[model samples]
Target: MYPFNCSQSTTTTCNASLYHATSLGRHDSTRQIATYYSVNETQLHPITGIHNRQDYLVTVPCSCGTVSGTTAYFHAVNYAVQQGDTFSDVSAEVYSGQVWVVGDEKQRFVAGNNVTMNLVCGCLDGKGTEEEEGEVIVTYTVEDGDTLAASLSRVVGLNELLTQNPGFIDVGWVLYVLKGSQVGCGDFEKGYFDAEGPVRYNIEEIEEATNNFDESKKIGEGGYAKVFFGILRGQEVAVKMMRSNKSKEFYAELKVLCKVHHINVVELLGYASGDDHVFLVYEYVRNGSLSDHLHDPLLRGYQPLSWSARTQIAVDAAKGIEYIHDHTKTRYVHRDIKSTNILLDDCLRAKVADFGLAKLVERSNDDELIATRLVGTPGYLPPESVKELQVTSKTDVFAFGVLLGELITGKRALVRDNKEPGRLKSLITTVSASSTHLRITLKNMDILCIKMVQPVSDLVRNLSGSSLEDQFRNWHASSLFSSYPI
Candidate 1:
């Protein structure tokens, strides 16, 4: 955990109160206190400079005797460590007895650098002894797209979590999370979204807006949330009314969507929560989900997307995933990257929706595999998800590869046709069952229905390969140059 300065020692006073933190100027030490979860520093590093000093504020709990308390520190010492000094070396030189240094060795203390040793108030974890909140079982249901780190971060700020649950966290494996105000919805509300006010809407206002949840007004349905088409304040809106019993997914998605904003992402306009009902209001896209346009033939008022249109849809959807993957302030993996999750606008623009299954990863550091229960749609699940329950951005990439096949072939990821006597075959299964000759498959199946161009054919060949990374890169690149004469 990163250290923060406490200007005054709690040795004199301890009272139950929220901790107050102040930013100490940055040091030449390669490490930073920004990752200290108590503070909201989502970006990897904005303090990478050799000549400038940055300020970082961190909050930590203070304990006084047997009661919870906090203290103010006005004269905290900030040490400017030279090249030869380590945290241990500095702690021994600066503080008197029983001072423990808490920084990584990889970060060398540079000359002319300043570092603050946060005075440890009696036992940070409530108890007077050194024992931290060891383990208190809190049943957090794994949301649709949650990775272990994101889930843990939700329960406890990232700093304490590293100390409590040090290694890989799995989905659906009930684990213990930190309890109390420090790691609850109250903390997230105060620290994360203090700037945005009144997220919660009135249930009565929503009911009147949606005509008392009229059947006709219902735009979409799912296990966790039912989407309604509503007009709020004279603009079209999609209101997601979550199952009152399952507030976990509601909070999970809201937490993520609140931080994320993009044209290609469904906007979370507002929300309402009460004892009996909870609702999320979003910007309503006139066209339905990609699934409705692509596969639901009975639906009216829409023409089948032309090859160019479909290609554009693919590009837009890819951009949404790219935003979630790498472009966002913090990288997120959309575990459920499938057609239904991709919604369409009136102008045929695609927006990625349903953040219920997304997980957060460090920007440019997504290769770390998170092991969890297999939870994505069957046909869209990657090989690693099924075989080892491991998840990464490539898992989304694999699912996107399936979505690409869905777009190109105009077929469901898994389906059964009476003409084919066998059971349901996934798109991958059909591709694999086809003969080694790519030309024969194209000639017979006429998948995509375009002239057999070299680039398109090569893309089809790439689908059969093992690397989802290569496949998505190839397809994303192809989507850029694709031209189909309709």
Candidate 2:
């Protein structure tokens, strides 16, 4: 179906729009109504919302025209579902993995027959005028465990997130979130302003905060960095300490960290350098990590995450990964994406952390496919990353699938090693059939992930952001593999 195109000379002027679309199912938070009427993918500027100078709500444009001497703002089309059409993947080729038509729309999609679709739109008139003093309102039908913070992820931060979306959001409640090209909020509002540049701290400040690198102040540690909990101007923050002279990694990490600013991704507040040591300060997430809550809650002194929480965590982490993969100027492959790297706040909201292993993908004949030395936690890496040593965006996708399995089964990616006592077994071998709740769905999945010690590559590549929520409704998590050889 082609769009109803009109010349600029004949096109009519329509004021600020208030388009409304309903999510018919409980699992999906967002859905797209097929608008064959749009001539192209046109980006629309902010219309109704009361936005500050910095952030602008990003949206797509729609056409409006007069009919029977009355102005009508609507677009529709008739479409016959094809053979392979399904509810979430209807017939939109460009909008794959985001087709969330349900209820009557679900029936129409399943019938493989002709069905009419349209965009519902209207405007709230104020004082006899089409203008209004409000943002574009999108009404969402809340699911079982949707909190206001969950909607705030990837959209905005602290003050902006709270102010724009006030009141508690619960199941079956309607929740709204603001979106824009520059619309965002900082991690915290107390010590710093929103969208403030990363601060360059004096090394003495970090030394005093950590009490001269005292081990007692340490909160977390990794292969490359040690994390310490400290307070910065009445606000709690996590300071990661590392060696600056190690490799290109420190500079690379700073470069990558400064460029990204999304709610799902962890926020870097400032940094310091002295005596060949570097300190990176970040907003301290209250909860520990996804790995802690999932594996053994009783021993870890935490409660097991509910099924809904697991699903939400997956969605939130996916949004973070998707931001780095798609939104950044030079796309990066987060070489490390595991349950441990996903930290949670007091609200149990997930944010992706640690970009030390992240590699900037410079596409070329040699760089794109070049092999690097093996680095990453076991059980999360794929065959291409392990054997080929090739680091690409697909590597993160593979690790994420394993992380999803961890969320489902509450089992570590790698089990005890059978080949060598006190060692580890293949990651693919351990986690593939770990959960009775989930089983393999695809034949290629078995061949690639389970049958061999091989793990997920492109199996979960299609899954991202809110799509993870939609995936659980339909397919089981695919198999996983190891970064190490069997």
Candidate 3:
């Protein structure tokens, strides 16, 4: 993974030290600021990262020239207008937000100006040519009735096109399409523009598909969302309904899903957003999460996974994490890695899901640890995550190791109120005490493994002591654990 280096800034008063650290990994980087600025500002930059230049570069006259910070004053002002403020109203309070235009002499927005600025979409500018680098570019020719904006709308967001290519109007000109990077249209684009983003399903369509969100269709629920089985356009899908459309997790998941595409990662088909609720559409996996299969006795219709199937599930999940960390344009850390988030397909193949806590990191020095908020499920969290909020891909690896233990022992990570002394002891803490301890646990697992191969009653009647244990110990020493890095 690459390292991220943060740019430094100094204020005139006391030389305010902006502790700039290189991008540790995807888990540390944020999307609040546009890429036009530093990879991601961590200094005096706001929590959302986008702010006016005057606020930070007070002593400077031209914020554009102030290379100390890649301050985009217009972005905050843009957001103000997008939130329903008029030109006059926004300009009046622009200075308070420390916003200003670089070339404008008056240092204020001209009143009643429509063409001067795109009030509709303040921060989401342009067709994102750089953003669409890996996308397959296709061509579209303007029809007789189509305007330039209309022509481009068929391929990309009109506002984004206007931002990317200003004054693009030709009746018959050819336009390029960046396969799947279009923005959504709704109240979000009330009077501004229109285009397709990832699939957008109407609320009614979602309701109808899920039988009006019938309880029977409800598959799973989480801290911030719920998953329901649905059929849209004749294709089965899993619709994840969020508490609201504006939460940080919704945007985080959307941003991560927009960039990732791999068989091992759950495919995001499209989404629906509104003031009250947001729904994410994903390719449905018929079998439930790996946790349910491994630990839920009430889970119906499915037999226990074979030993080979368990190993394959781990391998598939590892590939998904590998793609996120190494193959993305930048490194990504799946902060919440657990059996619950690993779903099994009809063929019992595993695919990683739930990227609400995923982080985008840029490679700079090495895969340095960066500070972030501590957020993840209980037993799966690593020591650094719980102690200091310092995390790297190694954090996910630690969680994966715990998951592997669950698969091997056929036990949950945390066993509550068990006969065991430590009621909530994590599987890793228990079995990973030492190599000898792990070997002993594997030896007991050998008996469980044999039950799958031979009837337990017959094995008890016919088996000799230490024979099966010896065979498994030999295999475990040479074949099983040897093949795994853990």
RMSD to the true structure for each prediction, in A, is 17.4, 15.4, 20.9
Most lDDT-accurate candidate? 2
Question: For residues 226-297, what per-residue lDDT tens digits would candidate 2 score against the true structure?
Answer: 999887766678999888774466677787877665567887778888887888888788899888897776
lDDT of 3: 0.52
lDDT, model 1: 0.52
Candidate 2 has an lDDT of 0.54
Q: Give candidate 1's error at residue 312 in angstroms.
A: 0.3
Query: Higher-TM-score candidate among 1 and 3?
Result: 3
Candidate 3 local lDDT, 35-64, one digit each (tens): 212221211222111121112111100111
The number of the candidate with the highest TM-score is: 2
Poorest 10 consecutive residues by lDDT, candidate 2: 37-46
Q: What TM-score would candidate 2 get against the native?
A: 0.54
Residue 185 lDDT in candidate 3? 26
The 0-to-1 C-alpha lDDT of every candidate, in the order given, reads 0.52, 0.54, 0.52
TM-score of every prediction relative to native: 0.50, 0.54, 0.53
- Which ranges of candidate 2 are over 4 A from the true structure? 1-195, 363-369, 417-423, 433-486
